[model samples]
Every structure is written in structure tokens, then in C-alpha cells.
Target: MQTLDLAVLRTLIAVVESGSFAAAARRIGRSESAVSLQLKRLEEQIGEAVFVRNGKQMTLTGAGARLVGYARRLLDLNDEALAVSEKSIDGTVTLGVPHDVAETWLPAVICGFRRSHPSATLKVIEGRSAILQSRLADGQIDLAVVLTATRPANALWSANLPMVWIGRSDFHLKKNEPLQLAAFDPPCFFRAAAIASLEGADIGWSIGHASNTLPDLWSAVSLGLGVAVRTPAAVPPGLTVLDGRRGLPDLPPLHVSLCGPPVEFKKPAVDCLRVILEECLAVSIHAAA
Candidate 1:
């Protein structure tokens, strides 16, 4: 009986996660032609086309999607078995994540890390991006995922995330009234960007609510208290994204960066978590988009 090759499955996953064969090649340290060959081999073994072209992008076929689900579990178990056989990786690795991200792809990262490094202790600290950055700088956390206007010098991975205005589905703007806004407290990047965009557009606005915690901010927005500006990653269930059609000014994109200690000070477990963060975030954010 023929079985699927693990290396080919890994290449398939890399292609899906990175959104292109070229990107998958770069990610997996293989030549572009080699990546293409592996994927072709996979299709031959599976007896189905795995990817179909959608305009300029390649998306998974229905069969491909189901296969990817199986691929992930297979790889997870394979990695777990290998890690258990090798000298076990053990140490406390603290991860810092901003409130927005903590709600979205963070859980997958946590689970993936735990599976591979079962002996390692993982601690998570959630706060605003600024606070997370501070904690990383002070060695309070081994790694941090933070938002910035520009990518930092030592980012392990970075992506530009578009920001959007969000409010309750039925929320409406009153004509000739100041745009009511709900957001985090001062020193928040999203809040500052929202205000800057409105001011630049000469749009009249006033803060309807401000809170330090994301849940409270989301609560106010969901209650139709006001609209809040944030990345599309973690918009609450009841809220809808507002656009130019809603008379909301377009907000600028923010950089999401994964940062960690200098290479000299980095531990093996920290490196493992870093890989998981990059892979999971790349896949999750791309799917969200």
C-alpha cells in the first residue's frame, strides 16, 4: 500500500499557508522548481488536483482542504513523537500578545507549541501592544507579538494588517452630528490612528466611550455606543465592519511583528515557539483576509 510522504505533505501545507508556490519554496528552503515538483508528486499520489487558480492567486480545491486538515494532524503527531524521542525540550517560555491578537490566532500558537514541547512550561501575558513591547524589552517575556507603525529591526516575522471601523450591524450615524467613537484608553495605537484619520479628513468626532480592556471596548461598540477602529482579526460576533459607505474614514494599516530576545540569549524552546507563532499567524491572518 502506498502512503503519502511527510515531506510532500509539509510542502503542501507550506504552499497553503504562504499563499503561493514561490513563497512556500522560500519558507521551506527549497528551490521554486523543487516546490512545484513536490506538489505535483502529491497530486499524483492523491489522484486529484490540489490547487486551482483563482485569478492571480492559488486556492485549495475541496479535496485539498480536507487533505490539509489531515496533514496538520499527521504532522503534529509526527513532531510530537520526534520531540519525545529526542532530548526533551524543557524550560519556561513566556509569550506576550496584544489584546487583539490574544483573542484570535494565539490559541493555535499555544496549542501547537504545547504539543511539540510538552515538557516546556508556557506562560502567556496579555496587554496592549505598547505594554507587551515594554515587557519584552525588560525581559519579562521571552517573546512578544506587537503592533507598530513600522517593522522593528529584529522582527522574526511581520505583516501589514489593515485597520477598519467596526460597530453594531444596525448602528447608524446621525446627520450633522459628531461621529461617536469607542476605543481603548489613551496611548493606544488604534485609538491614536482613528483620531488622526478623522482629523486628517476633517471629520467631526467625539469619544463616546473609552476603556482599557478590549472586552469592555467591544461591549460598548456592540451596544451601539459607538464605532471602534481595529484590525479585522478579532471583531466580535455581533459587530460589522464599517467602510467608506458608512461615512467612516479609512484608517492606516499597522505592522504586526513577532519579536524575541537576541540570538545569543534565545533558548531552543523559545525558537520552537517562534516558529509556531510565525506559521500560525501567517496562516490565520491570510485566511481572515
Candidate 2:
């Protein structure tokens, strides 16, 4: 446990950010065995294990998670120090991310790209999936990350994500009273599914809050305005996910898709962002599982 080498630190960050050593290998252009051995060496140097295997997945220990943020900052500084001779991957790439993902996974993706492609700016637009899709089609954004019920053939990658009912801890439901809901304006993936579930179950409901963004909806929920649907991983601090026993109709899982006709993108700026975003999202989807 002397000192953390720059190469090892980046490798450690890759494994945690990519959710698996194999995925990390692809991210860093290394073989799986190389990544594993590097991790082993990192453990020997630190005298503490960073990750624990869970069935086929690799879950970060508490120590590992703490190191992830530190590793990112370290690597960013490392890159900054080495930036003089490197060709700048600098450009503004417009990206649209779903509201849920923007809350949870988007920040890390932004950080990774900032560290790895410092001058390349990701100008983001956050909205409901449908709205994002429309913006993508209109070329208002270069890419869209959507939560969709069905996987589209053109999706670069996608993963199943479970969503839940969420609100303040003290929020309660009355059997005879309409279940109030807080959600984004219409054409939202969460809103549509939530509304459908209530309708299908023949539950009486009212819209207690409707906003254009996740924070406002969350603020409404926190105020005891109404319950809302969200992924457990993205639930705002102080909000509690409702248990099935709460009797709110269940919401189905959805796929988070990176909008793509992958072949259409050939620029380094686009490719770099695509890979960074993919890695960021992989961690989010798997960790939630």
C-alpha cells in the first residue's frame, strides 16, 4: 500500500464505471485478463479489496465506490497535465437524456467525458422520452437517451430498468379516495405508464402535480402534493419508494436506449461521447439491478 499508480487508478475507475471488468476492458482498450490483473495489483498496493463478485456481476464495496469519485478526479488532473501534445477532441455535441437518467446517470457521464475529452462539451437537453425522440428526429440534438417500452432496432444499446412509485415517507393512500399523482407534462414515459396502470386497475386518481422537469415533480411529491413514479436508483433524497403492500398499481420496467444508427456517426467527438455515455449508463442499469 505505497502509492496508487496513474495507470492503476484509471483502470480501477474504468472497472467501477463500466460495471464489469470485461466492459471496462472494452472501455480502456485492454483485455479482460489484463484488467483483472491490474485490479489484483491495485488491491495488493492498497491492501484492501475494491470490488466483490456477485454471481456474474461485480459489485463495488463501500471502499470501491468512494474511490471511484477520487479516481475520476485524479485521472482528470492527469489528463489535464498531459493535454499539451494531445489532439483536442473539442466540440459541442448536443445530447438529450431522459429525465430519470439525467437525475442519476447523466452527471457521471458528463464527468467522464470532461476528464477524458476535456474540451468536448456535451450540451444536454433533458425531457420525457417522447419529447426527446421528437427533438432527435428534428435534429435538435445529436443523440437521445430514452426510456422506452420496446427496444428500437436502431438503438446503440439498452438495458432493462425497474421503476417504482415514490413520494414522501409519510404519504398515505385512502382506499375510497382518488390516488393523486405527480408527474411531468404529458408525452412522458413514466407518466403514460403510471396513468395506464391506474386506469387498468380501475383506480380513481387525480393529477396533483404536473411539471416540465423531475425536480419540480419531486418537490411537489416532497410537499405531500401526490405520489409519483420513478426508478428506485433515481428517487430524490428524502423520498421513499412505495412498497407493493401500499396497493398502488405496479408500473412495468422500461428500456434505457441510446438513440442511434451507429454507422451514421463517424466523428471522433461523437464516437468518444457514445462510448463514455454507454459506459456511464451500464453502471447505472446494472447497479440498480
Candidate 3:
């Protein structure tokens, strides 16, 4: 039986991610013809077409999508085995994440990293985006996942996430009354975005509840105390997202960025964590979409 080649799998991933054979060649530093040859070998070995053209874009075939997932696991295991042979990743790695993200997607990332680098110590700092960004800049944290209106200079991965109004399903807004807002305190990105969106549409609003923690804000919104602006990823089971049809102004998309220290200051453990974060978050985004 023929076996899949790791080099060909890498070429497949590069093509899928970069969106074209030429782009993938540039990314992996190979000639376009060589990239094509690698993909041809991959298809020959698997006996299936790996990609199909859709309009102006190239997308993975069913078999290709399945292979990509296994490819990632295979590559990760291969790399980790090599790294362990050299030296175990044992140094401390500090990661900072905003309260909302910490509640939603961070557990999987932490668990995966710990399992992969059992000897490495992980320190997680949870706070608002501004605080996390400040800590990252001060070298208080080695990596940060923060929400921003624009892309950060040091971002490793970033995605524009749509903001929604979250509140109890039964909650109703009385006409002419100020929209009751539940959000984090000042210096908070979500609060500012919520307020800005409201003010832009000349909608009167008042902070019915403010807290430094996401749980408190979620609790307030869930209890029907007020509506809170946040990403859909953070919406709890009891709370529902409000859209324009509900007479709420549309909140702008916020960038969820994974950032780290300068290139010179980055460590191997930190780099490993970065890859995990990006991979997990990319899955989340696709699932959400």
C-alpha cells in the first residue's frame, strides 16, 4: 500500500492556506511547478482529487478537508517528537486573554498546550483587553489574546469578529426609555464600542450595570437587568443575541488578535502556544461562520 508523504501534506496545507499554488510556492520557498508536482504526487498516492475550483477561489475537496485535519495532527506529533528528543519544553510561558475569551475558548487551548508540553508551566492572566495589552507591552505576559478595533503591529493572527447585543430572551425594551447597558467599566473595548454604536445612531443609553468581570456582566444581562454588547462566541445559553431587527444599532466588528513580544524575545514554548491558539481559534471562527 502507498503511504502519504509528509512533504506533500505540507504542500497541500500551504496551498489551502495561501489560496493558490503560486502563493503557496512563495510561502514554502519552492517553485510553482514543484508545488504542482507535490500536489500531483499527493493525489496519486491518495487516488483522489484534493482541490476543486469554485468561481475565483480554490477550495478543498471532501477528501482534502479530511486529510488536512489528519495532516495537522501528524505534523504536530512529528514536530513535538523531534523537539522532545532535543529537549523538553519546560520553561514558563505566560498567556493573557480577555475575560470573555477566557470564559469561552481558552480552556481548550490551555488543555491542549499542557497535554503537548507537559513539563512546561503555563501562567494565564485574565483581564480586559486594554489591561492585557498593557501587560503584554510591559513584558508582564509573553502572549496575549486581546480585542482591538485595528490590527496590532505584533499580531500573529487576527480576525474581525462581529459584535452583538446579548440579553435575556424575554427582555423587552420600553419605547422612549434609554437602552439599559450592562458592560465592563471604563477602558473596556466592548463597552466603548457599545456606547459608540448607540451614540452614532442618536440612541439614548444608560449603564444599568458595570463590572470588571465578564461573569458579572453576563449575569446582569441574563437576569434581564440590561443588554450587553459582546461577540456571539461569549453569549451564554440563557442569553440571546439581539440584531438590527430588534431595533438595536449594528455594532462594528472587532479584531481578536493574538500578539506576542518582539521576534528577538520570543521563546520556543511561546511559539508552540501561538500555533495552538491560532489553530484552535481558526476552527472556532469557521465553526461560528
**Candidates, ranked, TM-score:** 1, 2, 3
lDDT (tens digit, per residue) of candidate 3 on 1-289? 6677655677688888888987775565444555677787788888888888787688789998999999989878866775563355679999999877776667657766776787788999988777888898888999999899999988989998788888888766667899999988788788899899889988899999988777788888877778998887645667788867788888888898999876677888898898889876765553343
What would the per-residue lDDT of candidate 2 be over residues 67-94, giving only the tens digit for each residue? 7778888877867765662366778888
Ranking the candidates on lDDT from highest down gives 1, 3, 2
lDDT measured at residue 225 in model 3 versus the true structure, 0 to 100: 74
In terms of lDDT, model 1 sits at 0.81
Which candidate tops TM-score?
A: 1
Candidate 3, residue 274: the lDDT equals 89
The Cα local distance difference test for each model comes to 0.81, 0.77, 0.80
| C-alpha TM-scores of all predictions | 0.75, 0.72, 0.72
Could you give candidate 1's per-residue lDDT for residues 186-261 as a string of tens digits?
Answer: 8889889999998998888999998888889988988877899988765666788887887777888889999987
Q: Which stretches of candidate 1 lie over 4 Å from their true place?
A: 1-73, 84-86
RMSD (CA, Å), candidate 3 to true, equals 10.7
Question: Which pairs of residues collide in model 3?
Answer: none
